[model samples]
Target: MAATIDELIALVEQNRDAVVGDLFPVREAAPRLIEASVYHPVICLILQGSKETTSHAGSVRLGRGDMLVVSHDTPVTARITGVPYLALILPIDLERVRTLEQSLTSADAGQAASVLQATVAGSAILETLARLLAIRPKTPEDSVLTPLLLTELHFHLLRSPAGAMLRRLVSPSSHESRIARVAALIRRDYARVHRLADLAREAGMGQSAFHHHFKAVTGTTPLQFQKDIRLSEALRLLEQGAVSVTEAGLSVGYESPAQFSRDFSRRFGRPPRRVLQGIAAE
Candidate 1:
């Protein structure tokens, strides 16, 4: 008796995000195609085969025993590659991370390496999260087991090799860490104009280092990251009934509406007006 893909899907269905509960699962693959919308704080692990995520930051490659953790709300074009690309995904809540970060004290943490990428692999954590994903919703009988398991997961992370990689990941220090702070700022205020000089100064690093570290941390240039953020936010606004593409662009710091249209079209596969029109018709 082995776990099947249908069982995994049923387990996933039981732990809906609407219930604010995380899901754990082992998924089987279909050879034709598999893709998904960008998600938030996803811990994706390939237990058997492989998958690729196409993001503004570029493609993230994961394979057997390999994992990738995205700590933010990311926009990506993703597809599973190869046959039998079995995998596991765990959705973490932002508030949960915030709470864990507050409790952990690795005061001597260092700046990320010069080639730091947002993606990192932690086999130990992957094993635990993957096993959790294989299980579904629990009853009062297992209430004690759930918190105990989650607590162990949190502590084990602080003790793992992944924890060693984060000297300043949880705090602000050095060029790379500060620029990560700036990335957080952009996510919060993607609609505002951001000056490089201002960001560099705020990061407490030289402009050149700021640029270098920003690229290293995010795997994308600053302007490109901001542009992606702006466009993503604008689309969210449009879907919320912003009414005018020009208004959305202007709000997100695009002084030229036509330029906004071109960039937005390139990123989103269609111009704003037509995209919204299609959405409205839907």
Candidate 2:
């Protein structure tokens, strides 16, 4: 296991600034002070050193041998706690999860949060991940084999102790899944004004029930969730220098420049210009 980890680390270091296949680069020199946008569901395994994640739901610190499961798109503040942090990021395969859901009995279903932290990972899971890292997909057959390996990895996770939370994510009838659908809608059209009633209708729930269940699953109300997504996109625009601050605000559905600035400052701990300035300096 130690040797496999070492091999994985070496592969990550060699591609420190680039993603190798589906693996996100794992290089950070300092603890990031600003929240980075996490726009999808993924499983992150800490292979070396440690890191921390803070969202509205709560905060979690993950060290070597720990894994984190994020079940939706959410804004999270993350920073490395140990120098030279190394981690493996795997995107969740919704199709594979849905397939696994069909085989789950009623007894396998349970309510679980969108975010989970686990100290243990199955050895088989780790070995399979290592194999994925080692394989170079240069041919069509290799590419075909990659998804199969990823499916196998998902199967291992579904049977692990952490499977319950994952099961809830894929169960079409589960409240968590319903909330996920709404969250996806919010992400897809965050720039548009969303009516609570309409969103509730789409989720097949009453307004009050949708409000309660959305908050329970996501740790924030629908409006707050939309605002977060909007601000995150606006921040990205500002960083990219693609638009002026006013334009960025307007593009993301904020009509009032003053209101946008206030919300942006409150969320990011600085005004938009200053944040952009800092990024430029970096």
Candidate 1 per-residue C-alpha lDDT over 90-182 given as tens digits, one digit per residue, 9 for 90 to 100: 564434444566667754355333221233445456444534554445655245455555655655554554443333455545454476567
Off-target runs (Cα >4 Å) in candidate 1 are 1-21, 24-40, 46-51, 62-66, 72-74, 80-127, 130-147, 154-175, 237-242, 280-282
User: In candidate 2, what residue range of length 10 has the lowest lDDT sum?
Assistant: 107-116
For residues 1-282, write the lDDT of model 2, one tens digit per residue: 533566667766654544434756565667655564754878888888888888777788888777787777777778788866778888887778888765666535543445544556668787877767666546564577777878888887776666666778776777788888988999999999999999999899999999999888778899999998898889888988768889999999999999999999999888988867777798
Given candidate 1, what's the lDDT at residue 30?
A: 62
Give the whole-model CA lDDT for all candidates, comma-separated: 0.61, 0.77
Flag regions of model 2 displaced more than 4 Å: 1-4, 11-21, 279-282
Q: Which candidate has the top score in TM-score?
A: 2
How many backbone clashes does every candidate have? 4, 0
